[model samples]
Target: MICESFPVGPFQCNCVILACEETRTAVVFDPGDEADEILGSLARHQLKAVFLFHTHAHLDHIGATDLVRTKTGAAAGLHEEDMPLCENLHIQASLFGLPTPPTPPIDRFLKHGDSFSFGKEKVEVIHTPGHTPGSVSFHVPAFGLLTGDTLFAGSVGRTDLWGGSHPTLINSIQKRLLSFPDETAVLPGHGPRTTIGRERRSNPFLV
Candidate 1:
């Protein structure tokens, strides 16, 4: 198992590259704005990307989707529920004063409980909608968890953006995220990584 995470784009969205060292098969999670960085990382590690999995569809989270897929020939994937958010890239970019890059149609729709493979590891999609209508968390139990906007290091996802609902975020956290084992390593979409047990005991959101 191999993992690499770095911030990309103006918003600095955390882009993660998880790969199987033995098979050299990888998945680029949230490509964001820097396609070159993503591809460079892949080259440095000598891994072949098989899938592009996104935790959600905010413009900042998907700024470089097309560039990455075009270069790597990897399948771009996102939650079905976030298509509206993904499609509204022009509006989303306008909100942040950034030029919108045309996003191509998703190659695949990721859904709850759906599983995808990258070499020896299988990742399951967990529909943890709160930050957005289609927000999800990727669970690779074999290599810990890659939680996107759904969970953070200490604080939980903000429920003030489009399609965001406070109650919904809390419900998703309590019902879905906390259900994982206490020891499961949690790598959120932003900020430092944390653990389920740590977030449960120390996080104000859980209390």
Candidate 2:
């Protein structure tokens, strides 16, 4: 597995490029902004993107979905429950005084337990809402867990936005996320990465 994550857009959402080194096939997670940079990374890695997966529909996470999809011809996916937020990019942008980007169409609706394979690598989708009604986390058994905004290094995702629920978010983290191994790397949407054990024992919200 070849995994690389970088922050993009003003919000600095973490954009991840995960690929199977043997097959040179990739799946891009959250092409928030800077389409050029995302594309460049794919080219640099000599990989072909087959899918664009979004953890949720927040503007900062889906802003560049269309551009990347157009360039790579990759299928775009999001949880069906977040379609409303995905369709309301303009409203989300207004709240932050940012430019509204085009709403990208979802080629697939991801569900809990969904699995995708790019060559020998496989990614399992875990429906872990709370941050948004449809928020999800991607788990690669051999690598790490992509928690989106659900679980962070020392904290957790905010639940003040549309469809967000504090109880649900906490439950999701405790049940869905915490079940992973202690050493499982946690690749959050923003900030530095940490491991499941570190967060479980010390994350203020979890502990």
Query: What TM-score would every model get versus the actual structure?
Result: 0.97, 0.99
lDDT of each: 0.89, 0.95
In model 1, what lDDT does residue 58 have? 93
Clashes per candidate, residues 3 or more apart or on different chains:
1, 0
Query: Which portions of model 1 miss their true places by more than 4 Å?
Result: none
Where is model 2 more than 4 Å wrong at Cα? none
- Expressed as tens digits, the lDDT of each residue in 111-198 for candidate 1 is 8999988888889998899899899999997877888888898898888998998899989889988999999999898888899999
Query: Model 2: clashing residue pairs?
Result: none
lDDT of 2 by residue, 57-147 (tens): 9998999999999999999999999999998999999999999988897999999999999889999999999999999999987789999
Total backbone clashes of candidate 1, pairs 3 or more residues apart or in separate chains: 1
- The TM-score of predicted model 1 comes to 0.97
